[model samples]
Target chain A: MVYDVSKLTDFHYSALKEISNIGIGNAATSLATMLGSEVKVMTPDLKVARIEEVAEFSGGADKLVSGVLMKLSGCVKGYMVMLLPPESAKLICNTITKEQDSDIKNPMNESLISEVGHILGSTYMTAFSDFLKIDVFASAPFHTYDMIGAIMDNILIQMSQEVEHAIILDTLFTLKGNDMHGKLLTLFDPISLELILEQVNALFR
Target chain B: MIVIGMADYAVTRSPEKLTTLGLGSCVGIALYDPVTKIGGLIHIMLPTIENARFTDNCAKFADSGIPYLIEQMIGIGAVRRRLVAKIAGGAKMFSFNSDASMNIGERNIQATKVVLSEMKVPIISEDVGKNYGRTVVLDTDTGVYYVKSAIKGENVI
Candidate 1:
C-alpha cells in the first residue's frame, strides 16, 4: 500500500497528537524530578512535509544547533532527533550540573548533554511503548553540533530513499522561570507510519 | 552564493560560490572547470535510480545526477576536457547498525566514482568515508573545495 499523508483523517491526526502529548508529559515529569526544577514540554506540532521543506522548517539550514539523534526499532522504526540551539544546550547542561558546580565550557559537558539526551529518548520511547502496547526501543543517542541543515540532511536522506515525504512531529521543551528551550523532532518511516495509522484506526473501531 | 538543498543540483559561473551542508550518508559532488571558472554541485541522496519509483529529479541519485550535472556545466560553457571533480560528504553517522543499508555512505561514494569515471571526469580530490558530518563549499573562481567538519575542523582541497 502506498503511504499518502493527504489521506490521513482528523482522527488520525488527533490520535497521534494525543500519543505525543502523553509521551512528552511523561518525559517532562522525569526531567523535572532529575533536575529539581519544573520542566514544561509543549504539545507537538505535527505536519507532513517534503524533504526540501524540512531544512527551512525550524529555522534555516545554516542555523547552528546541536542534535542528539536516536534510531528506533521493533514495532515501528524511525529516527528521533532532539535539537537545541547552542544557548539552549548550555542552559540544559548548566541546569543538569548546577549542584556539582560544573561549567558548560568543560569538555565533560558534551557527555553530560549526551546523558540528558539518553534520558529524554528513553523516557519518550517508554511512554510510547506503554501507550501503544507495542515493543519499541531506541539506540544509544549520537550527538552532533553543526548547521541545522546538515543535521537534517543526514536524516532526510535516509528517509527520502524510502519515501519523498516525512511526518514531522515538532515539540518544544522549556524550563519554568527560565529562558531555556529545546526542540524535539520525531520522524516516522513510511512503513511504520502506515502501521501506526492502522493501529490508530483499530482503536476507533 | 548558491545553496543546493538536499537532492538538488545547480550550475554557476565565477564569483558565485556553491554550498551544501550536513552530509551524513548523502554525497555532495562538485564539478569545476578551471578554464571557464564554471562550477556545479549536486547533493544526491541515494546511489542509483534503479529502485527509484520516480526519477523526475535528476539530482537525487548518483548515476543520473552526476551525468546531469556534467551536462548542465557543459551547457553553461564549461569544456568537458577541463572539468575536474571534487567530492565530499558520504559519512556513516550511525554505528550501531551494521546493515547493508547503513553502509550507504560507502556505496554512494563508490557509485559516484563509477559515474564520474564513465563520464570521463577526473576526480581530483575527495574528503569522504568517516563517522562525522561535513559541509562542503565550492569556490567557482579558484575551483577550490572547502570542507568543514565538527571534529576535524576545516580543510581546503
Candidate 2:
C-alpha cells in the first residue's frame, strides 16, 4: 500500500506519540538505574520531515554529539539513534567511570556509554513490541562521537533513496536536579512507517 | 567560508573557502580552476536522479549535481577546460548483511567519476571509500582539498 501523508489523522499522531512515550519512559528508567540517579524523560516531539531538514532537527549540522545507533528489524525495519550532547555525555561517563570528568573517547568511558546505549535500545524495542503486539528486534548497538550532521547523513542517505520524508521521534532526557541533558531520535523507514499506520488504522476501524 | 548542506552546491571565487560536513555514503565534489581561482563544491547524496520524487533540487543527486556545479563555476569566470576536480567522503558507516543497496558509498563514487568524466573534468586527487565519516573543505585560494576523519585524522588531497 502506498503511504499517503494526507491520510494521517490526529488519532494516528496521538497513537504514535503514546507508543513513543512508553518507549522513552522505559529507556529513561534503564538509564537512571545505571547512573544511580533520578532521570526525567520528556514527551517526544514527533513529526514527518524532509531528508534535508533532519540535520537541523537535533540542533545544527556542526554540533558535536555522541550517538549510539542501532538497526531494528522483525516487525519494523528502521534505525534508532540515542544522542547525547557533550555535556550530557561527560556527565554520564564520569558517573559510570567514577572520574571527575571522563573524556568520552576514553576506552573505558566509551564502553560504558555503549552499554548504556544497548540498554536503552533494548528497552525501547521491548516497549514497542509490547504496545504493537508484534515481534521487534534490534541489532547490536554501535557507538560514534562525531558531528550530528555526519551521523544522520549516513542514515538518511540510504533512507532518501526510497522515500523523500521520514518519521522523526525526538525525546529529551535530563538528570533530576542537574543540568545534564540528552536526546533520543528514532527514525522509521517508509515500509515500516506504512506498516505502523496500517495497524493503527485497523484498530480504529 | 561557505557551508554547503546535503544535496546542495555552492560556487565561490579566490580568497573564499567552500566546505561541507558529515559525508556518510555521500560524495563531496570539489571543482577548481587554477587560472581563475574559481571553485565549486557539491554534497551529492544519491547516484542518479532517475525516477526521483523530487527533481527541483538537482544538487541532491550525482547525475544532475555534478554538471550543475560545473556550469555554475563556468558562469563565474571558471574555464571548463582549465577545471580540475577533487573528491572525498563516500563512506560505508555501517556494514549490513551483504545487501547491495548498503554499498551506496561505492556506487556514489562510481557515479561521481562517471559524471566528472562526461563533463571532461580531470580528477586531480581523491580520498574516498572507507568505513568512517568525513568532513571536507576546499580552499579556493590555493585549490587544496582537506579531508578530516576520525579514523585517518586529516589529509590533504
Candidate 3:
C-alpha cells in the first residue's frame, strides 16, 4: 500500500526550518543581552507531526511545567510549547534568584519553560514581523503543569477534529557562562503554515 | 491583575480585585462572604497532594489555598457560614492522553471540590470543564467573578 504525504511540500518544510533557525537566533541574541551573560544558542531539531500525534509523542511524561505562546500571524495561530527540563529549570531560577533557589518549588520564581517562552516568542514574533513587515504580539505567558497534554485533551474533546500538523521549531540556549540550557520552541499550526507558505512564495517570486 | 504564583497566596479587601489570564487547566478559585465583602483569589497550578513537586503550603495546594482564602475572608469578618465560593478554569486541556500527566485539570477540579465540601463551603457558582483556556477575574469590590474563554464567549464561571 502507498501512503500520501501531501499535507505539506518539501520546499515548504525547508522554508519553515530555515525560518525557525533565523527566528530562534534572533531570540537567543535578545535573551543573552537581557541576562548580561554569555549565551550560546544551538540549532534546533525539527519535527513535523499532526497536533493529534503530540499525545503519542509525549508518551506519559509527568506533570512538568511548559511555557506556551499563542500567536497569530495573518491567519495562523497555535501555541508554542517549551518544556523546561528540571535541571534547566533550576539553572534559570538560579540566574534570577538573588541566592540559590530552594529545593522546594517556588511560585515566586518564574518557570524556565515560560522564561524561554517569553524569550523565544518575542524573538520569533520580531523575526516574523520583520519578514511580513507587520506587528504581532503574544499574551502574557502563564506557567502550568501538563499544559501540552491538557491542550491536546481540549482539542480532542472540543474540536473533535485533527488540528493538522505542527512544524516543531526547537532550539537550545546555553546561557550564564554556559551553565544554563533551555529549549526555545515555535509550533505553527496549519493556518499559520499557509500564511507562511504564501509569504515564502511571495519572497521567491 | 494579581498573579498568584504556585505555592503562593494573595488576599484582597473591599475595593481591591485580583485577576489572572490564560489559565490552561489550572484552577482559579475565589472565596468571599457577601456580608463582609472580604474576598481573595488563589490560582493554583499542581494538585500537590503528596508534595512530590514540593508545594506543601495550604496557600499553594488547592486543599490549602481554598482554606487559606476562606480563612482570610473570615478573618476580615466574612462569616464562614455565609461565604460564597466561585471557581473557574480546570479545563480538561490536552485530552489526547488519559494519563497522570494529562489529568491535572480534572484532578485540580476534583480536589478543589473535595476540600470545599469537607470544609462545608458551598460552591455558589462554577465555570469549569471544557477544552478551551480561561481568564478568571475576582472583583473584591463586589465579590463577583467573570471568566472569559480563550476560544469562545465570556461568562460567569
Candidate 4:
C-alpha cells in the first residue's frame, strides 16, 4: 500500500499518541534513575490547541520558574514544552543540588535551569523516540523564566507551521519521590501528528 | 548611593552602596563623579527600544535610565563632563535558544552603549557577554565602582 500524504494529519496524531505513551513511561524510568527511587509519571489528559493557548495556560500559575521548549522532528515536526512551577523547579534542583545544600530555604541557583533542561528534555524526547521506534535529533535545549507576554510570543512565533492546526499534549507529571510535581506539554502540527492518531486508532481495533 | 537588582534599579545620595547584583540578561547602568561621589545605578531588563520602560513608577528603561542616573548625579553636585558611565552584567545566561527572540544579555549591552553614546557620556568600562551573572558595586565612599562575575572573580568596571 502506498503511503498517502493526504492522511499525514491522521498518521501524525497516531504517532504522537504512541510517542506520548512511551515517552511518559521512559521519562518515569529516567526520573527514577535520577532520584535513586521509583517515581511514577502519569499519562496526562490531552488537549489540542494553538501556541497562543499555552500563554493563557501558563498565566494561571502562581509562580513559574522555567519554560522548556523543544521541537520533535524526523517523521513529524511538532513542538513540546515543559512548564515547571517554581516548586517543581526547586524539586528538580534538589535532585542534583540537594546533598550540597544544608537548607532548602535558599533560593534555587541559576545552574539548575540548565540541569532540569537536560533531564526533562531527555525524558521527553526518549518517549517520543520510543513510540516512533526511531531516534529524533533535537537541538540544544532552549530555556526561559518569568517571561512577559512579548517574550513568549517572540520565542514561539518562530515556529512557522506548514499546516493550519496544532495539537496539545498536556501531561501532568507527578514526580512522586520527593513531593514535587511538574507538567510536560507536547504540541504537534499536521505534518506528524495525524499519523500517530491513525495508527493508535487502528491498533485499538 | 544607588542599588540595582537583576532587571531593576535604584538611585539616592543616602550613602548606601548603589549596587546591581546577579545581572545576566540586564545591564547595571552606573554613573558617578569623583568631585561629589554622587552616584546611581539602573537594573535594566531587556536592551529594547520598544516598551523599554516597564515601570511607570520610575525611569525603568535603559534610554530613560542613563539620563536619570546622570541627572541624579548632577543634582548632587556632579558635572556632566566629569561623569562617566560604567556598565556591568549582560551575560548570556543560556546558549541553547540562539534563535529565540532578543539575545537579551547582548541587547542590554548594546543598548546601554547606544544610550550613553548619544548623551556624550563615555563608557569607562564594561564586563559583559558571557555565560555568567555579574555583581556590580559602586562605592559612595571613594567614588569608585567594580564589577564581578562569581566565576570570573573581580574586575574593575
The best candidate by TM-score is 1
Measured against the true two-chain complex, the DockQ scores of the candidates, in the order shown, are 0.46, 0.53, 0.06, 0.05
User: Which lDDT tens digits does candidate 1 get at residues B5-48?
Assistant: 88899999999999987676789999999988999999988899
Candidate 4 per-residue lDDT, tens place, B7-126, comes to: 345555536787754555667787777666677778765444354222442343577667776777777677899878778766665565566454666766788899899999888777
Candidate 1 per-residue lDDT over residues A1-205, each given as its tens digit:
7578888888888899888888888877887887888888888888888876786785677676777888888998777888878887787777776744544436688677777777887798899888777788988887777667667766777777677778877888898575878887778866788888777777667
- What would the per-residue lDDT of candidate 2 be over residues B40-130, giving only the tens digit for each residue? 9999998999987678889999999999898899898899999999999787766652587668888899999999999899999999987
> Candidate 2, which CAPRI tier?
medium
What C-alpha lDDT, on a 0 to 100 scale, does residue A129 get in candidate 2?
81
lDDT of 2: 0.85
Q: Give the candidate number with the greatest DockQ.
A: 2
The alpha-carbon lDDT assigned to residue B78 of candidate 1 equals 94
Query: What is the model-wide C-alpha lDDT for candidate 1?
Result: 0.82
lDDT of 2 by residue, A17-68 (tens): 9899999999989888888999998888888888887887767766777888
Across B83-153, the per-residue lDDT of candidate 3 in tens digits comes to 77888878765433357655667887888888889889889899887756676678877878988763466
Error of 2 at B73 (Å): 2.1
Query: After TM-score superposition, what is the CA distance of residue A129 in candidate 2 from its true location, in Å?
Result: 2.3
